[model samples]
Target: MQFSADTMFPGDLFEAATRFAADTLAAGDRANAWQQAVAMGWPALLVDEARGGAGGTLADLGAVIEGCARHPVGLPLVRRCAQAPALLMAAGSAGADDTLRALCAGQVDLDVVDAPALTVTALADGGVRLDGVLEGVDAALPFTHVLVSAGALLLLVPQDALPAPTARFVGIDGAQIADRVLSGLLLPASAVLQRGEAASSAAAIAQDLAIFATTLDMAATLGATIEQCIAYLSTRVQFGVALATFQVLRHKVVEMYVDYESASVLLARLVADTVVTGRLAARDVALCKLYLNELARRGAEASIQLHGGMGLTAELPAGRLARRLLCAGFAQGDRLTQLARLATEPTAARL
Candidate 1:
């Protein structure tokens, strides 16, 4: 039942993604990075094939993520971007088709309602009222539209229709997090994406996909960080030939490698299971998220600590990995939130 990475990424997708990541990752320029990703057609990774996208699977996206791990863009790009298009494809409506085209063309970005600062209210005449302040929006790209969830119902609201952003929070890597108060902004009936049962169902599907994609991306990023750490430890000299010669540092590297492999195996199995079932294995996703978060933190901290005084320096890749790992926790749900969900799942199912 064990699945290898080759079983998931079957073509040049891996090579293309790796080359793209290598060229653009950690460039410290969002505009340049986004343009490169668009050129590679990565933003449309999961859009339906008929929609002018590459029409690839989650595994393809996983390969791109793995390749980009040495230098990551953002979780939302894989999570929300991929998830939104999938939902639009599912809607199979005229509006969805238009949005799908825009998304695949890399003309707009999508937002997830993770922080819940905005409130959606049903208005008479079939319109909806959105109020309250939305905070912690991971808006790295200049978005043309946003997907907002109201009462678990997915609603597509044009960015122009929403209130202007009044404040912003910037990440250590220069990513922008927008905060805005939507004061009684009214969306027409046409903005209704999924309502009633269909609305919640689409939300669940998108959320599940986001969780699964984020887990694989985390594994890839951490795995690359571990490799870099091992190389540094094996070459840097101490009182002896190299730091790798030390049994303690060697043990640390081995443990971190094993952890990375374990996470990778778990992710592969989940991918296989999803492909086979045509549905998300929620219990497993929760476990993978919880398990990988701890691994990412430990691996990053260890990489930095093992690198000695130069570890935390900006020039060192270890510091960058550590910083990224620390920053990405809140993107989906944080580790604590994921852990609580995992605690309720059957122990046997997580395997």
Candidate 2:
């Protein structure tokens, strides 16, 4: 499963994803494919060797995600593989050990949906409580645990204890969107990842990891969108000529390439910096998430438009690819919110 630097074309990643997708479609086992992927060491690749991971770099993990996106893997690889581990590491908790082990062993399915708090629901000496609902939780369905952040406090709650499931909505990917009522879910002292954070070192790590995960997700979508466009243009014909041969179509395809390349380079640079500095700014991370996610969405939309009717059908892979990209756009944070945060934050210039 190793890729040589020279042989690691985006096409290679696409082919791997396509093969996985074909197998999933043939077996009618989207969940199984995701399980197999996890068991084959996808999660372990994101954790450091000390934390039961394979010690792979962020770029390496991004490549795996890129490959997985080419097919319908049915698992949130970016969040589980990249975000959760980084958050645990930053939180400095042995409590996360069980969760981490389960993740590496493919024994647990975890999903996180965090939002800024609107009101103080509960207050205690050592812990505070949140009562707001987060927008995207469907991909986290059957999630073992849900991670919640309010102010500087981060809480981990068993999914079953959530107040209500009435907040659920349908996501772009057709998964259940998680919108749950917090009400008064009690958070114990042990549940908090960080308390009263003035951007503690551990909290910083978690934030950076979250940002890293979003960037990787963008990379995955970019890879898939590019591949779909290529496939569509190759087989689709127009006016006794290939659609790819038209000057307009050629320009669109090249634009897709440029978008993918720019996102890829940004991801690579972010990964390298994370390894070297072990820290990245929240604003910069938001910018990356904003730009990359938007780029991916645009790329997918362009691919669909170019492919015409077939692009919207379930029988065509481009449809699925587009759905996944759209879903990823709202996974970590909404694009508008991220953009606004980036614009208003003093760190905007620094990033």
lDDT of 2 by residue, 38-136 (tens): 667776776777767787766566666666655654566766676666666566566666567666766666666556653445456655565666556
Count of backbone clashes for each model?
A: 0, 3
Candidate 2: residue pairs that collide: 137-178, 138-176, 138-178
Q: Could you say which candidate leads in lDDT? A: 1
Best by TM-score: 1
- Give the lDDT of residue 226 in candidate 1: 77
Q: What is the lDDT of residue 302 in candidate 2?
A: 86
lDDT of candidate model 1 versus the reference = 0.70
List TM-scores for all candidates, in order: 0.87, 0.80
